[model samples]
Structures are given as C-alpha cells and as structure tokens.
Target: MSTDQFTFTVSKTDGTARTGEIRMPRGVIRTPAFMPVGTAGTVKAMYPDQVKALGADVVLGNTYHLMLRPGAERVAQLGGLHQFMNWPYPILTDSGGFQVMSLAALRKIDETGVTFQSHIDGSTHVMTPERSIEIQGLLGSDIQMQLDECVKLPCSDDVAEKAMRLSLRWAERCKVAFGDQPGKAMFGIVQGGAVEALRIESAIQLAALDLKGYAIGGLAVGEPQDVMLRMIETVEPHLPKTKPRYLMGVGTPDDIVEAVRRGVDMFDCVMPTRAGRHGQVFTRHGRLNMRNARHAEDTRPLDAESKCAASNAYSRAYLHHLVRSNEILGMMLLTWNNLAYYQELMAGLRKAISEGRLADHIAEVKEGWAKGERDGVVEPIDDKAIAAED
Candidate 1:
C-alpha cells in the first residue's frame, strides 16, 4: 500500500550504519541513497528516464536557479516539477540558502532573511524562511529543506555559533510555513561550520522539532575529509534514529562510504556529473582521467564488466579521441558512466549493510580504489571472489 504520510523504516544496521526505506505517496527512497543534482529540473547531459533507470530514487532541484529562470509559479502552472520534467518520482528542493551564501559580495544577510542580487541578472530579491517553503510547495517538492545560514569553514567560533542560532530560528519559521503536509516532509539542516558543540546543539535542537528528516550541512564547503567525517560523527548521535539523516553536498566515493559508516542515510552532490563533464571517469577501480595520453592507444572498454552501455560499449581510445576533440557525445557518455558507477556503489552499500558486513565491504571497496590501475589498465573485479569474501 502507498503511504499517505511520509515515513522511514530502518531494516538493518551494521555498527552505526543503517539501510532503510523512506516511503511516501509517490515512491520509496532507498538509503544510503545519493541524489543527483538536477539543478534546473534537468540532470545535465542525461534524460529523466535514464536517471530513473540508473537507480536514483530522487533527484535534487535548486530553488534559486528554477525561480530565476522559469519561476516557481510557472512550474506550478505547468503542473509542478514532476509533470514539467517528466519525472514521476519524489523530488527534493533546496531552500536556496547555500546558493545565496555563495553569492558572497552580491548578498546581504540579516534577521529578516537573505537579500541578494541575482547572478542571472542585476535584479534584487529577498528569500525569507516563509518564501522558501512557498517556493518548494509550488514546485511540489516531496522533501523540502528549511532556509539556513551556511557559513564557510575555518570560521571563528563566534561566527559558527551565530549562524547556528540563526538557522535554528529559521527552522522554526519554515516549520510553521510547512505545517500539516502529510504526504511531504520538511528537513531541517544542521549548520555549525566545524565546531563540535555547535553541531551537537544544532542537531539536538532540530531533532526536538520532530521533523520528517535532518541534514548535516556546512562541512563540505572547504574542510578536510577528516574534519568532515568528524563532524558527521559528532552530529550523528544527537539526531533521532527514526528519522533520516542527510549529509548535504558530500563528496568523493571514499567520502560517501566513510560517511555511511558514520550513519548518514541520504546524500547529494555534483561530483560525479561535474567530474564526468571534465573527462574524469569513476569506476570500481578508482578514478581515471579519460583525457590522459595513456588512454589514446588503449582499446579496452572503460569497464567491460559493467552493465551500463556507455561503460561497456565504448573503447578507451575512442573516448580519449572524443574527449580530445571536445565532442558533445563524449560528455554525455562519460556523465552516464559516472552516474552509473555512483548508483552501483550505493547498491553495494545497501547490500553490505543488510548482510551485516559493512566494515569488511568498506575495506574491500577502499582496497579496490587503492589498487588503481596497472600500466593504465584496470582489471575487472571478480564477483565470485567478492561474494566469497562477504
């Protein structure tokens, strides 16, 4: 039966790590899930159908971009983001807080909310907590985030505490604006920049709201990998276990795996797609620069053992040539391959946690990356050996 009220159920656990499903009227989202960034309703270089088939339960939309170009009301009139984009599944939309903060010199922050000049043009706009919720509602976002202040890392203790307090205040306003949406969810973002006390306080206070979910933000801005992981560790305990925990804008495959181990249930990032467009390929054998000279004469497929057609059908030499020539098809193929690999990794993590061997699975996955490539050739993984190890 389809659930009318948003709900999450944890089915398995390995240490602090967990595997679960978030059930809503539209669909079920598997965790530890990775949401691809579909900034302006479209995932760059890929079709919606392809995105669904690649194992993504949800794709993220940016409120700032959409509101600027197409406008939120326009999307609603056209039948919301799902009907407009041809994606029938759940969609999560950011509150535009991160993008607003990124505007730096172009924006001014105060108690009323952020006032910023649009990058698309010189027009000025104000995005209070209420306005952000209204935009998400207009776009029919299944999962919505509260507007929060996201400060860059290496900030002072005073700065982090101030941002955290403001975000907590905003969370309250966003909650009131998001009242009684049974079929949807409002997630409060925990922002403390890199401070342990501030992160804990943010998580505890947000969890007190008893919202549908929580997200750990403010870490991936410029901090070290260790610092990011530590923040996750610090915040995880304070968040409620029943609700989902999201690590916002998290990074590399290694970062995802480690964060999952630390108990994050959801994630979103532009790493795979962004890296793909730049001729970078992520694989079970680690990252490969397709534009490298070594691939120019190689004839092997990027990953002959994989199921994605782009990964299995194209030769390294052809891909290299396409990248070198700046072919559009090259970007398309590489983006497809990268998204496929990320989904594959998510599937592996789910399976590992279910079978109670996440620790070993993580070690093997890291070992695969450690074993990079031999003379520019990445040997195929043996499924039988992996199963036996499990």
Candidate 2:
C-alpha cells in the first residue's frame, strides 16, 4: 500500500455512471460511495465498528467541528484521527472553510484567510489555506480537501466571480502547503456559485494544478436540486477523467442518483444520520417516519428486505416506541438502518451500471419508493426470499 500509488480504476461504465475502486492505504473505497459523516469524530450514536459493519468504505471527518471541540493538535497528540477515533479505515477531512463561512458568525474574509468566531464557544480563529492543510495533515486524513470560499447561493455574478477567483488562489496555497506524501492525497475544490462561466473558469484553473482529485463545492447550500445537478454537468466534462469527481455536502437519494449520472464518483452528507435522529428512515419503499402513529403495534422491521440485521430484525413498533420514548437506541438503530439503505442503493447502482441496466434499476427504485409500504401491514419479506431474488 504505497501512499504514492493511490489510484482509481473504473471497472465498468454505463453512460456516465461507473463502477470503480479507489485504492488507498487503509482500504479500497468503491466509486459512487456514500461516505457517512463523522463530524466531531463520531458518526452520532454509532460505534466505528458498527459503521464499518454497514459496508462503509470510508467516512468523512469535519475539520471545523474537530478543531473546535477536541482541537486538531490534541488529535495528533493522541496519534492522529484514525487512532483518536479508534477507526482503522480511510478518513477524508474537509478544509473547514465551508463550515466557517456557513456556521460561524461575524466571518471576515480576506486574501490571507477567514476570521470568525467558533460556533461552539464564540472563540475567535483564523483559517488560512496553509493552516487548513496543516490541520488535515495532523489529522492524518487519507483524502484532504483544499480550503475554498463557499459563497451563499443566489449571489450576484460579481460576488460569485470574486469568491471563485479567491478560491483558485487559495487552491494554489493549499497545494504548496499540502506538500507531498505517499498514501495521502490533497483535493482541490471548484467554487463558482451557479454561473456556468465562473464554474468553467474554476474547473479549468483547478485542473491546471492537477490535484489528486477534484470536488465541486458551494452549490448545495440553498440551490434547487436541478440547479445543483446542472452545475455539476457544467463542470464534469472539464475535469480530468482520471481523477475522481466529488460533490461536496450533497444530497438526497435522488440527488445522489442524478449526480452519479453526471459522472460524480464520491459524495458526503449528514442527511442519513441527522435525519435518522429525527425519526426519518430511508428504505427501499421511500422514507419512513417512525414517529407516525400508524406504526404503533406494527411488528414488521423497517425494511424486511434489507440485508442489515438491524433493519430486518427490529420491529417498526419497537423502533417507534423507542423513538417516542426518547430512547438513545432509537437513534442508533434508525441511523444504522438509514446507512444500510444508502449502501444498498449504492450497491444496486453499481450492479446496474456494471450490467448496463442502470436506467431500468433506477426506474425500479423510483417505482418502489412511490409504492411505499402498505399501511397497518407487517408483511416482512423473508431473508431467504430476498437472497433468492438477488
């Protein structure tokens, strides 16, 4: 596992949807992978072991939260993020630029860096490209993102252009500060709001740096789903085909499918875990809300067809009870179920792409979601039946 030898290999391609593998020192992440967010060094209510058991190839760590809470220096002192979190798998750390701009107050942006108060305790901190790189390095991230300004959606062209240009300049600084390493890779993020021309400029400029990977940032903030998908299409063709394309902080199940169709290979979002805590569970037959009174006395699992034991073994009635009673296990079980659904979706996608049946598979998924579950029914599909179908 030579660090310098990190690579992505496309095994199959159907249209723009591809089934590939990203080889890293810790493990090989399957392309079109949905990385569960592990902000603050935990995937909220989940042990790292359980996360891995859900077939997660990699997990994302937040530089902003980690730096604010445990401090990057403290993590490094304890033997890097992998050891600090007790997860011996690949970890990708964001630059903290997005969080600082979006989550912090009184943010002052300058050519040098961004100054803002920590959302946690209102302490002041400045993050430069160099500092962002340094923090990620200390965290020992396998994939480190470049620090880039994330502009709010619906900004004027002039404002968007300035931020895009500044982000490109910062990308250069990030590259210089990132230096070089064997197994570790630094990625450059393209920021241009919603303008195609600025997006092209950002993509072309970042492409010139030739980072290990490229990520499209700043669109998912408040833009419409179609707008985000269109922006991705605008930038995808200009990016190097050999390097992986990542869409930052993106999306729902439908959003993921659309982005992959446009050639994105990686994604990270807090939707699954966050929504899980709030009683939303992703299933083959659309989203299920455990808080609904309809689920009371239901003996069926969240998804009888799910490969995950948690999804198939636990009754909806029990889960609903746990959630209504504010039991911690409710959050845990539902989070696991949601992640399992995501992984299952990814697997279906990969299989579809490989077999040149992505369109049909996607149609089936949409149809299943539309059909949903029968009300007041606990018709759990047996594991044997699901296995036979597969």
Candidate 3:
C-alpha cells in the first residue's frame, strides 16, 4: 500500500499521546480511536444506526465468528460485511488466527496452518494466513489484520521465541495474499508473548515487511498490567513512526490511558459493551454496578451531564429495576450508555493530545475516578455515624 493511498496524518503529539486521522475509502477514523466490537456482525443489542448515533467512527468484525456462522462467501454474496451489517462506516476485520487457537477444540498447530474443531456444533475448519487474508478481502474490510500465532503469557522463553518466529512467517503470507489495493490495507501483528527481546525481534521482522500498520497483539491476555505495559514500551520504539500502531483486545479505562501514554494509537476490546450487558456501567467515576442494592433506591441518572439520553435521562432506580427484573431494555440502554461513554472519553483524549495537555488530562481523569461519585455529585458520609456505631 502506498503512503498516499491510506494516509494517517498526525496533527499533534504531546509526549506519547497523538491526535491523528486515518482516511480510507469507507470513512475517516479519528486517531486514538476506540472501535466498538461488532463480533458476529452486530454490536450485541444495539443497532448499527444506534451505534453511529453514539458517536463511533468505526466498528470491528470478528473473522472467526463470521466465518463460522454465516461463512465469508455468504457475506460476499449478500454484498460484503458493510452492507450486510447495515453499517456504512469503516470496518476492520481480524484474521481468524486468535479464534483458531483460542476458541477451537482439538487444535493442532503446524507450519501450513491451524486445524481445529469449531466450538459451535463441533465442526472442523482449517485457517491459513492466505485464507485469513482472503476472507477479509471477501468481506471488503477497510482494514485487515494479519494472521499471527498468539502464545499465552507466562510461557517459557523458548516457546515465546518459536511463536514469534511462526507469526513472522504468517505475516509474510498475509501480505503476499493481500497484494495491492488503493484504499484497503493490511496490518501486521507483533506477537512475542512477554519476552522483551522476542518483542523487539518480532517488531523488527514485521517492520521490514513494510505493512500499512502494526498491531501489538498477545498482550492483555491475563498478564499483569505492569507486564503488558512493559512489553508495549519495549516494542513501541521499534514500530514505524509514520504508520499507525494498534493494541489488540486491551482493557479498562485506566489501561487505555496507560496505553496512550505508551504511544499506542488504536485499540479494540469488548470490555464496555460486554460489561454493560451484565449490569456494569462505566462512568467518569470508575465502574458502577447497577445490580447492587445501593442503586435500588437511587433515583438519579447514571451521569447527569452526559449528552447521551440513555445515561442522562434515566434514573438509577429505574435502571436497577429493569436489570433486576431481567428486562431486555436494560441491556440495550446500558450498552448505549457505555458505548457513548467510551466515545466521549476518546474525544477528550484527542483534544487533550492536540492541545499538548494529555499528561495533565490523564492525571485529572485518574483523580476523578479515584474519588468516585454518584450522578456526578459526591455524597459525604457522616463520620459521627461511624463513631456512634462503634
């Protein structure tokens, strides 16, 4: 892919935080962007229009899920993932590599590819690097990820080295299969488990391939937060500065902030949306559990100042009632609110980076979340009440 074909313009860089834009044929994705996961072609309870209304620039599709469910050929027959899903915005599709290793049963790894039984219905499937790229191309993805081997964290150094080497081989195959397209781009994944030397080796090998973008995969897979951050720090400097860097399947609000501080430009995770379905709501003041009894009598909105009606117009008591009663509307509303919150946070980070105040902005966010509040109003607990109980 030519540099002019898909452009990532860095408007400003404050420390490791950056504000930029990735212009593709489908649409423009703002940098430091958070892509809502639309695994299996939908964003769970929310519709595509509703997701766009929540201010998402782009959404992600899982290759393994789509390939197994409706099949890639079917999606192409139905007019690609964008039209099939009714989302006209840009979509990035993952290579089925992760699912082949993680979701499948009776897995066997070899140089040719991975062979495994489908978790759904116990069927069989084989996924190669070329096949993964072919599927993403069939889906007409704006951005496609390379098929790479992902080793579990806390593995032996020898195992980590072997996986990293295999991933490099797969990256080459994916790039060759992807060929050349004007707007479409393929991103290589950097996989080296927790070993810093292996991470550097993987980055150097993938950078030599000259792909459009690079993703730091194989982290946040149950590793401690500090170890993941250290791995990122080790690989960040090796990646090409002109191209975008993505961190796959990464984390909470604090994790996102920390990733930005370490020079990561893109992220995808199911945390907010998936967590919301189970009664967890993310706010400026940390995560709040709507299933808790404290919210049963609380009549305040989740966030009074939010522009999202789902968050600002509903009372905690009503939300709790819905969740407690197992109403489907509860999941819908919470998913919308959580997605809106994620987008709002990303917008703030972009603005802060462009203005050269990201460090201060991050500190302020940490402090605000540390001092948790309800409905944006802090309630002081009486110290005398505790003394009286004693």
Candidate 4:
C-alpha cells in the first residue's frame, strides 16, 4: 500500500464497464469507485472512519472551500489535508474552476484564470491554472484536477467552443505547475457543452497531452440524462482506454450505472450525503423520504436485507421520528445508509463485470428499483445465495 508511484490495473471488462484498481502510495482504489465528497476537508456529517468503513478508498477535497475558510497555507503548515482530516487515503482535489463559477460572485474570466469576489466573504481572489495547481499541491493532493471553465447549458456554440479551447490551453499550464511527484497525478477535464464535435475535439486535444487521467466535466449541471450520456459516448471513443476516465459531480444510482456502462471509471457526487441530510435515503425500493407520515407507523427496517446496520437494524418508524425531531442521529444514520447503498451498487457492478454478467446484473438492479419494497418484515438474503448470484 506504500509506494512512491501511481499505476492503474484493469482486471476485467464487460462491454464498456471495467473492474480495475488504481494503485497509489496511500492505498488501492477499486474502480468504478464512488468517492464521497469531503469538501472543505470533511465529508460533512459523517466521521472519517465511518466514511472509510463504507468502502470509500478515496474522498474529494474542494480547493475553493478550503482556500476560503481555513486557508491553504495554514493547512500546509498543519501537515496537509490527509493529516489534517485524518484520512490517510488517496485524496483527489478539485481545481476549483467549477466553484469559481458556482460559488464566487462578480466573476470575470481571462487567460490568466478567474478573478472573482469570494461568495463567503466577498474578498477578491484570482485562481489561474498555475495558482489552482499550486493550491492543490500545497494541500498535498494525491490526484489534482486542472482548472477549466464550465458553462451552463443553453449557451451559444461560440461560448462553449471558447471555454473548451481555453480549458485545453490551461491544461498545459497545469502540467507545468504540477511538475512531478513520485506517487501523485494530475487529471484533465473536458468541456464542450452539448455539441458532439466540440466534445470530440476537446477530448482529442486533452488526450494528446496524455495526462494521468481525464474527466468529462460540464455535464450534470442542467442537461438531461440522455444528453449527459450522449456526451460520455462522444468522448469515450477518443479517450485512452489504458488510463482512468472520470465523470465529475454526477448523479443518481441510475446515472452512475449508465455512465459506467459507457466506460467511466471514477465518480464523485454530493447527492448521497446531501439527500440524507434532507431525510432521504436510497434503497432497492428507490428513494425513501422519511418525512412522509406514512412511515410514522411502519416498523419494518428501511432495507432489512441491506448489509449496513443503519438500513437493516433500525425501523423506518424510528428513523422517521428522528428526522421529524431534527435529531443528529437521523442525519448520521441516513447518510450511512445512503453511502452503503452506493457502495453496494459499485460492488455489484464490479462483480458483474468480472463475471461477464453485467447485462443480467443491470437488468436485476433496475428491476429491483422498479419493484419497490415488499410488505411486512423482510427476510434478509442469505450470504450463500448472494455469493451464488455473484
């Protein structure tokens, strides 16, 4: 687990979905990995140990959030994010370009980077590609993303192409700023709106750099599911199969499944944690909103067959009570259940790919979601039967 080098090994492939491992100095990440967003150096409500225990090999840190709050230099003096957050695993740091658009106010973009007033305190700051890379390095990020402009949907072709070309140029600057590290990596983000030609052009240009990995950014912002999937398809053919392909800030269970089917190897999203805080948790029966009065008298666990205790041990009624009362335990348990569900989904996808039954697995997974929950006390699936399915 300890090394001064980074490498990716693919074990199996079923259509476009892959079962693989990303070996780094810190640890090995199992692919198609789901990284819980630990923005501002934490995964919000959950503890570090709990996040790792949910099968997360890595977690994401937000450069803009950390830089604005505790300040990046302070974190460096305090021993970097992993040591600061007590997560001794691989940490992928976003370049903050997305936030330079979403979180900052009065933003202005030029070749030098983004100049904007801080959303938190209205302080002025500039986040150039080099500066963004420097900030991530100061945080000692294991995997760093390059700075890129992400335009909202419905923008003109000229606007999209302009942003895409600028991002390609910045990707070069990031490479120079990142320099080299024995066990670290820098990934490029592709941006081109909804245009297939622009997506292919951006992908080809980024691939020419032959960076450690590549991410299809600028989707899931407002586009429909089919649009997002189409973009993935457009770019996948031009990307390097040997390296990892990531889809940033992407989505629901069905979203993840569909993206994986199109060859995306990594993902990071706030949906599970954010939804949990809102009294919602994912299950085989689809999303359950604990605030519903129908659960007030329900005694059955959210998913008695779930491997996570949060989902299998506590009754829906108790969860509903906690959520209704605004209890911290409600957030913690729901977040735990949601993360467990995501990890379970990833595990199933990996197994299906390895077993050459990805189609069957996908059909079963979708069917389970559509069938909804069973009535009364649900019987847990036996470990042996589960193994047989695998």
lDDT score for residue 19 of model 3: 83
What shift in Å separates residue 374 of candidate 2 from its native position after superposition?
9.5
- Per-residue lDDT of model 2, residues 1-390, tens digit only: 424467888899889778898897888888889999998888988889988988898999988888888999999999999999998989999999888987887789999999999887899999999999999988989999999999899999999999999999999999999887767789999988899999999999999998999999997777889899889989988999898989998778989988888889999888888877877788887777788888899899988888898799999999999999999999899999988899888888888888998889899988787677543232332323322220
* Segments of candidate 4 deviating more than 4 angstroms: 373-390
TM-score of 4: 0.95
Give the TM-score (vs. native) of candidate 2: 0.94
**In terms of lDDT, which candidate is stronger, 3 or 4?**
4
In model 1, the Cα lDDT at residue 320 comes to 93
Model 3 TM-score? 0.94
TM-scores for all candidates?
0.95, 0.94, 0.94, 0.95
What is the model-wide C-alpha lDDT for candidate 3? 0.87
- lDDT (Cα, 0-100) at 33 in candidate 4: 95
- lDDT (CA) per prediction: 0.90, 0.87, 0.87, 0.90
Best-performing candidate as measured by lDDT? 1
Q: What digit string (tens of lDDT, one per residue) describes model 1 on residues 1-390? A: 458889999999999999999999989999999999998999988999999999999999988888887999999999999999999999999999998888524988899899999887878988999999999999999999999999988999999999999999999999999999988999999988888999999999999999999999998887889999999999999999999999998878989999999999999988888777778888988888887888889889988888999999999999999999999999999999999999999999999999999999999998887777654445343323322220
Candidate 2 local Cα displacement, residue 203, angstroms: 0.6
- In candidate 4, where is summed lDDT lowest over 10 consecutive residues? 381-390
Judging by lDDT, tell me the better candidate of 1 and 4. 1
lDDT of 4 by residue, 1-390 (tens): 556788888999999888899989999999999999998898978999988888999999999988898999999999999999999999999999888898787899999999999988899999999999999999998999999999999788999999999999999999988887778999999999999999999999999998999999999887889999999999999999999999999878999999999999999988888878778888987778888888899999989899899999999999999999999999999999999999999989999999999889999998887676554222332323312220
